[model samples]
Target: MAYPRKPLFAPNGAVATSQPLAAAAGLAVLRRGGNAVDAALATAVALTVLQPPSNDIGGDLFAIVWDGERLHGLTAAGRSPAALTREMVLAATGRRAAEPVAALGGAQARGPAMPARGWLPVTVPGAPAGWHDLHDRFGSLPFADLFTDAIGYAEHGHPVSTGTAIGWARAVAGHAGLVGAEFAEFERVFTVGGRAPRPGERWRNPDAARTLRRIAETGADDFYRGRIAEALDAHAARTGGLISGDDLARHTSTWVDPVSARYRGHEVWELPPPGQGIAALLALNILDGWDPAGADPVERLHRQVEAVKLGFADAHAHVADPERAPVPTAALLDPAYAAARRALLTERAGDPVAGDPERGGTVYLCTADAGGMMVSLIQSTYLAFGSHVVLPGHGFALQNRGTGFRLDPDHPNVVGPAKRPFHTIIPGFLTRDGAPVGPFGVMGGHMQPQGHVQLLAGMLDAGLDPQAALDAPRWYWHAGRTLLVEPELAARPGLVAGLRARGHEVAVAAEPSVFGYGQALWRGAAGWVGGSESRIDGAAVGY
Candidate 1:
């Protein structure tokens, strides 16, 4: 079946998003002589104020940029404070590391009472550092100009899109009691009639507006080391949290080369080791040996499923911080290794394996300007509202990315002072010969790799347009056991049973199962073509 909306194919500049307003804001920036980096920065900042439930300024950011010829990955993820040790947390609570505390959704949960609050979900905030770093490197306009649209939205308010409203309603109802007073204030600004504001409803965030003004005036230092940092530190101390002013001041974003592997003559690039982008690359590498071009429908689907499993298995075992794990990057991407991995895929399915959740709630944006600069950017609060701890006076929630760290001392991703955790959120890009093909991202946690496979298949093998590739039916291996197929896919009567006959535990999800929010832009003979996911309330706009 075809998607409801037509595919967007632009020949010049284009922007796609989960919200039209956000896309328009970014497009406006591009039109005003800002490059892709500036447009992406503007969209990210606006999302923080407008889509509070899914993302925020207090979250982490990751990106892959097409710097003309090669791709570069930036790990804007933050780490625990230097003073934060597993031993300290254990000592404070007098509990063993592996012992299960209250379930995240259960009564007596130790973290913040509300899911949107900053206290329950605080981690090092990374977006500010990331924005500054990207601007310093590739921006054309003044740094302060990037905040104009975001600041205006935060102060004067923007209409809450349908997607934002749904997410906010869920977060407010699920986490109201868990959050502290600051978040309560946030709720007041966002909620209408004691619930999330519906689509087209104007929503303002005055506190965030003020915070943006401060950052524009004083630079990111106001956030990393100045008054905002002081407020964040004081709030943490009063709440018995571990973050300190020093952690805020010391936080920095790292720049590295993106990892890429060839598939069907096109090169797919993604963020390296710590992020799961490599997992997606690994999966594509394994599938490279399979003749997806001529395979029957069932045969093609089986190959893709097997590739996902093998890639995820390797991810669970090897993907972690390169600094700590000595990740065998060369070995894993080796053609021989891919051939060996592909050998494990039979004509049938098998038992599922559970994958870790890196960052769950996040937003992805891609932009390109007339200057030929392009950016694939992602930002997240880790989980909804992050640590759910709203900093008292800053109006920013913190990230809960610390959850990705393991308590096991032997694990490569073990929690330690100032160590980056295994990251799940990653941005992707593609190239042919030496030119940029598209900037893309898949947002759902473990579903990201699987989403990449499908998107690649649609674009490269099936010849579908970018929006069609995104709106196509998708499947996910949730918790590694159940195959939660999208309703559209599940409509095929014998498909689920066929997988079950092959030893797969198949289950039908009530909704669309795993929804992947993605956007893409490809260079056509004339110019650039872009498509935003129709499953979301986003739009693709260009000149």
Candidate 2:
């Protein structure tokens, strides 16, 4: 029988990434005898150039790698600048630290809540640190070798992908009106002729090329403790921003033990706290007892969304910097806790409050080499252009990841000095009976875990192929029963009716608010089989 969507198969190697150019970059590295780690870095770096709207060198990085032996996790997310304190933020924005973050222009009526659009929302960038850390450990290629594709694309040019074009234009439209110089840097880098780039239009960033070269030659030191740091400091000082050379110099990516949970016979692995990976595991854990395959299509999807709602609520309460997080990682992922949380899901859609749990885009790439090495990596510039503050001379955009923090001083993720805020982007991996299943991930904002759960259930429970599982109609449970379901699901005969009967406000739309793009690659009996996102301009390549 043929599958709903065909999977790309390869024996020597395979790559699945959001951008075709970046996937080619990885395939090139693999052809040169580079391992998965090298190819992954190359792909990641290339993306900072090709998919400039979604990610950049300025964002943080996270990855889960299987080096043919043990799974290794890397946390490259940066900390809040030491100079940035609750008092300082309150003084700058004139809002109490304890107040809930106001909407952009809500009557709670203050400046945009919690630095939603500027330097104050940017943490020290962690991408360079992460690249260096990955290379220093598992990479086979020289550091500079990874930059060739990225530099070429940035200096010469690259054609915008469909997904990237949509995102780029949306970002430009969102920030069209800003009075200050800090915001001008963002407009300068992303907009051409005061507009988002048309799809297939050629774009170049020589400034980013120069910056990448400096990072390449200096071994990433320039980004943290050297000239790169100086430029960042000068920008921050001039703009009255809190970042400094010390913040950049003090940053370090940490090596961490990955967390996992068993769903049926398969083990799903994700990065630990400070990331929302646990949320995916939490949802899966709750659904482990039920046989999703036995349920009707609507029933299966409803259970997944319900479980995710519970997981997100707990995450809101418990997940944060491990240092300040109220809920311990061990307690959060305990099967017993997941079981209890699972009980909250019922026949109707109702917002479930967290008892007291603990808790958590941009691009997701999975590359596998012949040697059995697989890397699941994700990086992103939070909130479009990220802080909407680009350095004048440097080519990279600063991530507004600091916007992930809470303004409520009592919250676990409350704004504080050097604290890593709650993060949304997560990388996922799967395995069965001690053997490698392969690397897989879905990229979007809060939609990541929801996508992961749906894809896994489609394959593991519903017996669908990789491509079929990914291409299957998806539902985005934004909050409670408010759902944005793909039009495909609407046409599933009675899928939408069943869901609406269960109290879900299902809005059937083709785009339904960035439902997320996914990529999956696993060790098949034949070789490596993989697939890319259908919603974007990309493909799965094998060789």
Candidate 3:
């Protein structure tokens, strides 16, 4: 069944998001003589307020941009505190920790976790610094202007979209103990009776508004080196947390050339190694070698699945911070190596097995303004509510992304001082003949690469529109050996068996699968075609 919503096409500028208000906010910025970078920054700031459960100012941000002539990537992902070490955490808890989510689950099972107290889970928040850096480098409008829409939404209130409401409700229920006085205060301002506010229900966040106003009045320094930093450090000090004023002062976003590879004449660009954007690139590279033009539908699906499995094997084995990771980038993406890896996919699927390679939220936006500038940006708190740490005066939560690091010293992504962990959040862009073609992203921890593969196959190989490609059925193989196929795709019974025959140990998803919340802006002959996933309650707007 097709979703009933009119598609938006604009010749000059457009924005697509999981919420219509956000799209409108970006479009408004574009109309106000802002470039794509400005529009995206506005929309991103707005999302932090409107989609609080999935994102916050205390999270991490990653982006890819088309700045006229070349593509650029911003890796503003947060890092573990310099004081944080595996030994320290193990010593504090008197046990070796699993993933952060695992620790959260354990805490839930027994009682409230330390993170609920708003101190222990704090990390060096990168979003604020990242936003400032982007504006300083490429934005056309005043940095203060970007916070206006976000501040208004937080203070005066905005309708809660269906997708956001559902996600919020789930987060609240899952991490009930994390709900402290600060969260309770937010409930009083935003929710009705400690429950999710329905779609069209008005919700406000006065605390967040106050926080934004502070940043606007004092500038980014207030966040990194001034009062805000002091407040964050104080909270961590009182709790068992590790962040320091030095960490805040030292935090800065990195600007680097976008990493990319050619796939079927289209160039796919993503952030480099420290992030897992290469997983998507590697998958596309493997698929590019396949004959999508002549292969049967089932055969195409089989090859795509095989390619992803192989790509992920490499990702798990080697991808990490380039400074620390042992595997060379050239070796991993080498054509000869890819051919050798592709050989592992037999005509028949392998046995039902978990891919033991690497370990693993979120808003995605794509904006293009009248200046011909484009940006694909993503930000998140890792899991919903992050470490569930809501700083008191900062009006933001912090990310638990440090949980992705391993305690095993031998692991490529093992936690260390000044090292970026293997990140799941990645933004993507596509170009053809050296010109930007589209800005898109698939957001879900491990499912990101899989989502990218499907999106590329649909748009480039099958010639489907952006929305149709996103609307198409999707699947994901969890690290736990479960093959969570979406209900729509499950309807095709033999397909599962076909994959099973090839040796995949598959099972139907207990809920909707972790495919991705995709958003994109495709450059077509007509103009810009903006598309947002129907699975998410969002829209694409253009002018």
Top candidate, metric lDDT: 2
For residue 319, model 2's alpha carbon misses the true position, in angstroms, by: 0.6
Q: What is the TM-score of candidate 2?
A: 0.94
- Cα lDDT for residue 495, model 3? 81
User: In model 3, what are the clashing residue pairs, if there are any?
Assistant: 18-538, 348-502, 349-502, 349-503, 350-502, 350-503, 352-505
Clash number by candidate, in order: 23, 4, 7
TM-score of each: 0.92, 0.94, 0.91
Question: Where is model 3 poorest over a 10-residue stretch in terms of lDDT?
Answer: 103-112
Candidate 1's residue-wise lDDT over 1-543, tens digit each? 552677776666777767777888888888887888888888888888877877888888999887776677899988777776766555544666665533221122222111223442256888888988898888888888888888998889888888777777777786666644535545554457677777788987778888888887776888889999998888778766778899898888889888788898899998887887777888899988888666656677767877887777677556667766687777888999999878877866744443545337778888887767788988888666776667655676777777766554545665677767767788889998767888987786777888888899889988988878887777777554466777777787677777777666767665431556788887777777788877667788888
Ranking by lDDT: 2, 1, 3
lDDT (Cα atoms) of all candidates against the true structure? 0.75, 0.83, 0.75
Question: lDDT tens digits, residues 1-543, model 2?
Answer: 424558898998988998999999999999999999999999999999998777898998999999999899999999998877777778787876555653211122222336677777789888898999999999998989999999998899988877789878878887876667777677667778889888899998999999999998888998998888999999989987789999898898989989998987999999988888888888888999677656788787788888988777767666788866655778878888987878878988766543221111388899999999999999988777677788988877888888777665656777889989888889999989878998989888788888899889878887777777788878787654688888777888898889889998889768733678899998998899898877786678879
Clashes of 3: 7
Q: Give the TM-score of candidate 3.
A: 0.91
Off by over 4 Å in 2: 1-5, 97-113, 353-361
Task: Give per-residue CA lDDT, model 3, range 91-110, as digits (tens).
Answer: 55556454432211111211
